[model samples]
Target: MAKSDESTVLDSGPFYHGTKAALQIGDFLTAGFRSNYRPEIVMNHIYFTALVDGAGLAAALASGDGDEHVYIVEPTGPFENDPNVTDKKFPGNPTRSYRSQAPVKIVGEVTDWTRLTPEQRQQWRERLAALNADPNAQIIN
Candidate 1:
C-alpha cells in the first residue's frame, strides 16, 4: 500500500528468504555471495519472494548440510522484480520474486511449510548438477 520513490505501489508482503545458513532473527541478508544455482558467479543482489512455498524450495535446493531455513524479511530499501524469472523464464512477475542490492532484515522464521522429500531433493540436485555441467547454461542475474 506504500508508494516507492518512482511512485509505483510497493508489493506489500510478508516476504521470505530461503537458505541453508543458520541465522537468528535480526540478521541481514546481502549480496556478493556465490549464486545458489550457479555457484561460479557472485550474485549482485539478494533475492526474496512473497510466496512461502517458493522460499521453501530455495532452501531445499540450497547447497549446504545445515538445516533449511525460511526467514521473514523486510527490505531496507528499494527492490525490483527479479529479472531472472520475470523476463527470461516467465512473463510478468507471477512468481512474486524480487531482488535488491540493499540488505533484508530478518524479522522471523517460517517452519510449517512443506519440505521436499528425499527423492525430490535428489532429483533437484541432479538437475542442478546437469545445468552446472552445461557449458552455456545461464542465469539472468
Candidate 2:
C-alpha cells in the first residue's frame, strides 16, 4: 500500500506521571499545580516520563504525606521535550522527560515500579534539600 498523507504521532509513549495525589482513572492532570520539586512555584507545564523508574523516583520524592503513585497517562494535546532535564541538566533527553500545557488523562495505574529503600529515599531527600538551599538553582518552569 502507498503511504498516507496524514501526519505521524510524535512520541510513542507509555508515559507516566508520578505524584502523591490520589487520582482515579479518567481524571485529568493539568498544569498550575505546585511543583513537586519547588512547592512555592505553580508550574506552567505538567511533566511526565517514559522511564518507569524515573516516575517512581518522582513519586518517592513527591511532597506531602499521601502515598506515592505512578499513573499511566495519555497526553490530551501536544507536548515537548522537557528542557529542564534535556540539555540543561542532562544532554539529549536521557531521562525521556516531557511536559505539556494540556491535560493528561489518567488511563490507568502502575504498582510494580521499583520503590526506593528508606535509606535511599532519605539520601534523595537530603540531595533535594541541598538543591533547594542553593540560591543559584532554578527550575525551567
Candidate 3:
C-alpha cells in the first residue's frame, strides 16, 4: 500500500506529570529536564507572566507540596520559541508553554523518599546504567 497523507493516532504520552522526586532521579540519571510553562520569561526562553525574581520555584512548591522530587536538568538543544509556537493557557491563566527542539538531560534528583519502589528503582538504575542508555527508558509507574 502506498503511504497515505493521514497521521496515525498514537498513545497519549509525553506525559510530563509524575512524582517530582522520581522525575528528579530520572532527570539526574538521564538528559536534564527542560523548563515547562513558567510565569517568568527573563531569558531568551519565552515566559508566561511578568518576571518574579526567586518566586517561581516558591510558587511551584507552594502549589505542588505533595511532590518533593526535584530534578536538575539542562537543555540538550536550543529553545524553540516563535510566534507560532508560543502556547497561551487561557483568559486568566498566566501559564505559557513551549517545546524543545531536542530532549533534555537529567543531572540529579532530590527527594525525601524514593518515589519509585525498590524493584522499580533498581530496574531503572539497571536500565539507565548502560553507556548509551535511552533516557526515556525509565518510566515511573
Candidate 4:
C-alpha cells in the first residue's frame, strides 16, 4: 500500500458590521423615584430590544415615562478575526493582519415627561406602585 498526499483548506472574510454601543441605567428604580419624589409613581423608565436584518440592525429604545432615564441598545459581534489563511508564500507564514470591525454608536436620552398623555402617566404610576409594594419586583434577569 502507498500513502496519498491530500489536504483541505478554508477561506474567511469580513461579512457583517462589527460593534455597537449601549447605555445601561445603573439604578433604574432609584433614579425614577428620585426624579418624581414619589415611591408610588414611576418617573424614569427605559426599555430596549434589538433585532438583526440582512445587512443592517434595528433597535427599539423606549421609556415608560418622560423621565430623565432613557434606554440605549447597540449592536455587537465577535471580536476575534478568522484563522484560515490564504495567499501565503509558505505553510507557516503571516498572510494578512487579522482585524475586526469596531462597535457602532447608539445614543439616547430622556427629554420631557410632559409629552405623555394623562392615561399614560396614570398607567406608569400604577405600575410603579405595584413594583414598590412587591418585594419580588427587583428580580430581573
Kindly provide the TM-score of model 1 when superposed on the true structure, using C-alpha atoms.
Answer: 0.88
Please give the range of 10 consecutive residues that has the lowest summed lDDT in model 4. 51-60
Please, what are the lDDT tens digits per residue for candidate 1 over residues 71-126?
Answer: 99999988887877775667677888888888999999999898999999899899
Clashes within 3 Å, all models in order: 0, 0, 15, 2
Query: Which has the better TM-score: candidate 1, or candidate 4?
Result: 1
Among all windows of ten consecutive residues in candidate 3, which has the lowest summed lDDT? 1-10
Distance from true location, Cα of 135 in model 4, Å: 1.2
Candidate 3, residues 1-141, lDDT tens digits: the string is: 111112222112111222223343344222233332221222233121111211233224322346433343444444322222222212321322222434545554333322445576466445435512554432211
Give residue 30's error in model 1 in angstroms. 0.7
Global lDDT scores for all candidate models: 0.86, 0.85, 0.31, 0.29
**Candidate 3: where are CA atoms >4 Å away?**
1-21, 24-66, 81-98, 110-141
Shift of residue 139 alpha carbon in model 4, Å: 2.9
- Give the TM-score (vs. native) of candidate 4: 0.27
Q: How would you encode candidate 4's per-residue C-alpha lDDT over 1-141 as one tens digit per residue?
A: 111113212213222211122344342211132222133444332212221221121111122332233233232322221222212323431332221233322343332223345676477667767766777544221
Worst 10 residues of 2 by lDDT: 1-10
